[model samples]
Target: MAQAADAEGTVVVTTTAEGGRAGARALATAVRDQLPADRPGVVAVGAESGGGAVIVIAVNTAARTAGQDASTLVKHLLHGRGGGSPELAQGGGLPTGQLADTLAAVPGMFTAG
Candidate 1:
């Protein structure tokens, strides 16, 4: 797993895990669970399979309060299709090479809370 934080204290984490969509979701949830209670964050978990990747984005409450939407982020950053509430979202069919870059850009997608 890799992590980055912005000036606003929003953390972004990226990880390549095993399982497919289920694994990605579990990883994202785990990352979110590990964050400090006061810190806002986003977790992007990707699993590579066949020729592409599956991604799951998990947003903590503080991050969601700061206007971060996992569903929108997955759609915009991964160029994939999926849906979920603002706090958690899952998507797939992303270019494997794009996963890192997409996760790296996550911190910048938030608005100040």
Candidate 2:
């Protein structure tokens, strides 16, 4: 797994997998504990499959408090690539490394200054 903090104070966490159910809540909890109390963020866990990759995302506290609807935000980020609720969402068919970049960029949408 890898983590990064952006200039807008959005925290991002990412993990890559070959094939398996990457628990969304577990990762979210772990990542949340490491995040700043005032930051909004997302954890994207991905798996390689067939000809593409699948990315699952979990939205964090900052986003909920910022009036950013997690589900909506994720859908926008995935761009019709996948679907899920605010607490857990998934998308597929992205290039190998695209999902990580997607997760890293999501926080800016909610925390942009």
Candidate 3:
């Protein structure tokens, strides 16, 4: 069975069923769905600089993210793209490399919205 991790915007399930892309696509969709857009004042707040790709999570535009600098965290959570802020965060890239490490980290992070 492909095991999908339970990160806020991801689902990491172990499986060679479809060469992995299937699960990865599922994760992207989940991320887009979970991103909060109609939450009223519950805005994300922040800023990031540089010329890397970005993954924007529609939450707020704050100055910091989960724990790291908005920009850095954005790079860390790529899904083919990357970007961030306290109110809004973005991440995207090949879910390979540190993908396992990222998925492993999901358990320690906040799960339910």
Q: Which candidate number maximizes TM-score? A: 1
Residue pair clashes in candidate 1: none
RMSD of each: 2.7, 3.3, 10.3
lDDT of 2 by residue, 13-55 (tens): 6666544345544555566566676777666666666676666
Worst 10 residues of 3 by lDDT: 40-49
- Rank order (by TM-score, best first): 1, 2, 3
What overall lDDT goes with each candidate model? 0.78, 0.63, 0.35
Off by over 4 Å in 3: 1-27, 30-82, 85-88, 92-95, 111-113
Clashes of each: 0, 0, 43
Candidate 2 residue spans exceeding 4 A from truth: 21-29, 97-113
Candidate 1, residue 37: lDDT? 64
Off by over 4 Å in 1: 110-113
Model 1 per-residue lDDT tens digits across residues 8-97? 677777777887777888889998988776777888888886678877889888888878788998887766587787988987777888
For TM-score, candidate 1 versus 2, the one ahead is 1
Worst 10 residues of 1 by lDDT: 104-113
